[model samples]
Structure formats: C-alpha cells, structure tokens
Target: MIIGVALGMMAALLAAVEVTATVRPDVVIGLVIGVPGVLGMLMILMSSRRWVTAVGAMILAIGPGWFGALTAIQVASGV
Candidate 1:
C-alpha cells in the first residue's frame, strides 16, 4: 500500500533523473512534466481500495500520468 506508493515515487524520480541527465531536457519540462507525473503515479500507487485506485487512475489519466509517461517515452524513443 504505502510501500508501493513510495516505491513508485522513487522509481519515477530515478527515471526522471536518468532522463534529465541523458537528455538534458529543459528545466521547465522536468518540473512541469516530470514532477507531476511522478506525483500522479504516487497517488495512484497509494490507493489501497478499489475506489481510491479508480480515482487515482482517473487523475493520472487526466494529464499528470501521461506527462510522466510521455517524458519517459521521449527518452526511450529518443525523441
């Protein structure tokens, strides 16, 4: 539960850091896209109940999660 959320957040941060180091992305992009993305993932991972997960997932899907995911994808795809 809590552990999962913590791990997810850490993973997101680490991935973001790696991307930042490798890609040298703009500072704004890292904050705007990376931070929220990781935080959204944390929110989603923190969900222990079904309803909570649903809400978190929705929040993630709405924007932040995609931002985070896209940031990662950008690195992977070399875009």
Candidate 2:
C-alpha cells in the first residue's frame, strides 16, 4: 500500500511537470515525459492490489489520463 501510494504521488508529480513543461514549447520532450506519467498512472490502477490503494490510484490518474487520452485521440485523428 505504501509503495502504491508512493508510485501514485510520483506519477502525479511527473504529470504536473510534464504539463508545465509542455505549456508552450519543447512539446516532444514534454510528451515523452507525459507518456510514461500516463502509463505509470494506468499501471497503478490496473494492477490488483489493495482496494484502498487502487482507489487512490484511480483518483490520482484521472487528470493525467484524461489529458493524455485526449491528446492521443487528437494525434491519431490527425494522422
């Protein structure tokens, strides 16, 4: 549970940094950081662990996952 929480916090912090970094320039680098952030968030949610941790991860992932999925959709659609 503690490990899960730590991962969730790390994922959230990574996403925050990615979002801030990508605000205007160096989009590719920002996306690179964000991809792992989103993946880590999903990993936390998908793994069968303590229910409390799972719920915490779910909450932690929502923002980053939403933005990442939205970007993925746009990029794929553009291609």
Candidate 3:
C-alpha cells in the first residue's frame, strides 16, 4: 500500500509536469485525466477500510472518464 501510494504520487507529479510543459490540448487532457487517477490511487493506498478502497478505485476510474469526455467536448466545440 505504501509502495502504491508512492508510485501514485510520483506519477501524478510527472503528469502535472507534462501538462505544464505542453501546449497541445490533447496531451494536456491526458495529463488532467492521469493526475486524478494517481491521486485516487493514493487515497486507496492510504485508506484502511475495504469500502474506502473501493470508493477510491471508483473515483480513479471515473475521474479519467470525466476528463476524457470533457476533453472531447472541448475539442468538438473548438474551445
């Protein structure tokens, strides 16, 4: 769990850096998706209860989906 948390934090940081470095909206979108995924994973690792872990996993899955959908809408709308 500790290892998972560490990896998740590291990945989130990396994704944040990537998002900052790029201008292409798609890569930014991906980074946006990734950051929350990592954070959710970290939450799962930190929590002791199975229910909390399950909720975290659900958040992890949903965050990226929201990001992707928002990105697609933005692209389609030329935002």
Candidate 4:
C-alpha cells in the first residue's frame, strides 16, 4: 500500500511537472493514466473480494496497460 501510494504520488508529481514545464501532451497523458493504474493495481493486490479485484483489473487495463502500449508503440516507431 505504501509503495503504491508513493508511486502514485511520484507519477502525479511528474505529471504536474510535465504540465508546467515541458507541457508535452503525450507524456502528461501517460502519467495521468499511470497514477490511477498504480493505485488500482495496489488495491487489486491487497484485496480479497472478487468484485474489488475485477474493478481493479479493469482500471488497471484501461490505465497503465494502455499507457504502456502507447509507450511501446512510440518507442518502436522512434516517435
């Protein structure tokens, strides 16, 4: 839980910085997706309830999973 919170906070901070400084839209988007994903993944890890796990998994897929896919595509395409 602590680790998850820390990672989420860090991602938020990074997004804030990107918004204020570079303002690169794509990076900001990825960070936005990642923050909640980290928390959702943490919740999934810590919970035993099936519904909670399912919700977390959905959030995880939409958030960091998509973010990772985008990043990989960008890297592969040299963009």
Candidate 1 versus truth, CA RMSD in Å, comes to: 9.9
2 or 3, greater by lDDT: 3
Model 2 misplaced stretches (Cα beyond 4 Å): 1-54
Better of 1 and 4 by lDDT: 4
Candidate 2 per-residue lDDT over residues 1-79, each given as its tens digit: 3444445456545665466543543564465445545655666666677764565555555445544544554477683
lDDT of each: 0.57, 0.53, 0.63, 0.60
Q: Which regions in candidate 4 have their CA more than 4 angstroms from the true location?
A: 1-22, 26-30, 64-79
Best by TM-score: 3
> What is the lDDT, from 0 to 100, of the residue 54 in candidate 4?
72
Q: Write the per-residue lDDT of candidate 1 for residues 36-69, one digit (tens) a residue.
A: 4666688778878887776565444434443455
Clashes of each: 0, 0, 0, 0
Per-residue CA lDDT of candidate 3, range 1-79, in tens?
3444444455545554455453686675666667668878897999999988976776576554555455455577687
Question: In model 3, which runs have C-alpha deviations exceeding 4 angstroms?
Answer: 1-27
Ranking according to lDDT, highest score first? 3, 4, 1, 2
Q: Stretches of candidate 1 above 4 Å error?
A: 1-25, 62-79
lDDT of 3 at 60: 74
Report model 2's TM-score to 2 decimal places: 0.29
What lDDT score goes with residue 13 in model 4?
A: 48
To one decimal, what is the Cα RMSD in angstroms of model 2 from the true structure?
9.3
How many Å off is the CA of 48 in candidate 3? 1.0
